[model samples]
Target chain A: DVKVTQSSRYLVKRTGEKVFLECVQDMDHENMFWYRQDPGLGLRLIYFSYDVKMKEKGDIPEGYSVSREKKERFSLILESASTNQTSMYLCASSFSGANQPQHFGDGTRLSIL
Target chain B: DQQVKQNSPSLSVQEGRISILNCDYTNSMFDYFLWYKKYPAEGPTFLISISSIKDKNEDGRFTVFLNKSAKHLSLHIVPSQPGDSAVYFCAAIRQGAQKLVFGQGTRLTINP
Candidate 1:
């Protein structure tokens, strides 16, 4: 079984603080993704990394950036946390194939005050 | 504009009955479709998927039906159980594309 693990299950941060969300996958997949799940918006992609040091912006990448220094770990950085940015964060990893299914980690529910 | 849409916000189904969740997409270029199931506080799990070459795919109690002509797809859960209740998200991607577009999910409740 594939396992994708997130650094935190729940988080709280003050406005204007910097936040980091970490994810690690054991399956050695080549693709990693960061997504924010909202009530009406569902899962909106924030950033994705195809390989080490290679990242791409997704639909909702504003105020967020990503780091993929290693194949097994991907990190999402919130430049300046705000109340509106509070939401559930999900990390997923998939194989290189186009039609392959993505395996997800248990999400981190971040609350910004 | 939202490329994928799931108009129904919620659905209630009796246990042992069938539950049908529908999804529609406006992007004609999307050639692959997938369904994901998510529990509260958990990330969405890959439930099932169907490529454009085929119209239907089935796995045990879950079946995914696709209609390319209408750019619509549906997921059917048979003998719905209480454990089957969750938020279902439909996603699509164009062939060879690195990104997948997701729809606003539909929450399904299975009543015991």
Candidate 2:
């Protein structure tokens, strides 16, 4: 079985604070993704990394950045947290293929005050 | 524009009955479609998938039907149990594309 782990299950931060969400995968997959899920909006992609040191912006990447210094770890950074950024963040990983199923970690519910 | 759409926001069904969830897409370029089930506070889990070339795919208790002409798809869960209660998301991907476009999702509740 593939395991994806998120560093935090829940987080709270004040406005204008920098926030970091960490994710690690044990399956050695080459693709990793960050998504934010909101009520009535479902899940929207924030960013994705295809390899170490490689990153690509997804649909909604504003106010967010990503780091992929290593293969097993991917981090999502919020330049300055805002109340609008509060959402359930999810991390997923999958093999390098067109239709490969992605394995996800338990989401981190973020609250920006 | 939202490429994938799940118009129904919620559905309720009695246990041991069939539950049908619907999804539609506007983009004809999408060649692959997937269904994911998510529990509260948990990320979406890959449930089943079907390719554009095929109209139907089935697994134990779960079946996915695709209609290319209508650009619509449906997921049927037979004998839905309490454990099957969750939010179901429909996602699509173009040929050779890595990114998946997801729908708004439909929440399904099963009554015991």
Which parts of model 1 are misplaced by more than 4 Å?
none
Model 2 segments beyond 4 Å from truth? none
lDDT of 1 by residue, B1-112 (tens): 8999999989999999999999999999999999999999788899999999999999999999999999999999998999999999999999888788999999999999
Give per-residue lDDT, candidate 1, residue A11.
96
Question: Candidate 2: lDDT over CA atoms?
Answer: 0.97
The digit string of per-residue lDDT tens for model 2 on B1-112 reads 9999999999999999999999999999999999999999888999999999999999999999999999999999998999999999999999988899999999999999
Pick the lDDT winner. 2
The lDDT for every candidate, in the order shown, is: 0.95, 0.97
Error of 1 at B15 (Å): 0.8
Instruction: Find the candidate with the highest DockQ and give its number.
Output: 2
Lowest lDDT sum, 10 consecutive residues, model 1 chain B, at B93-102
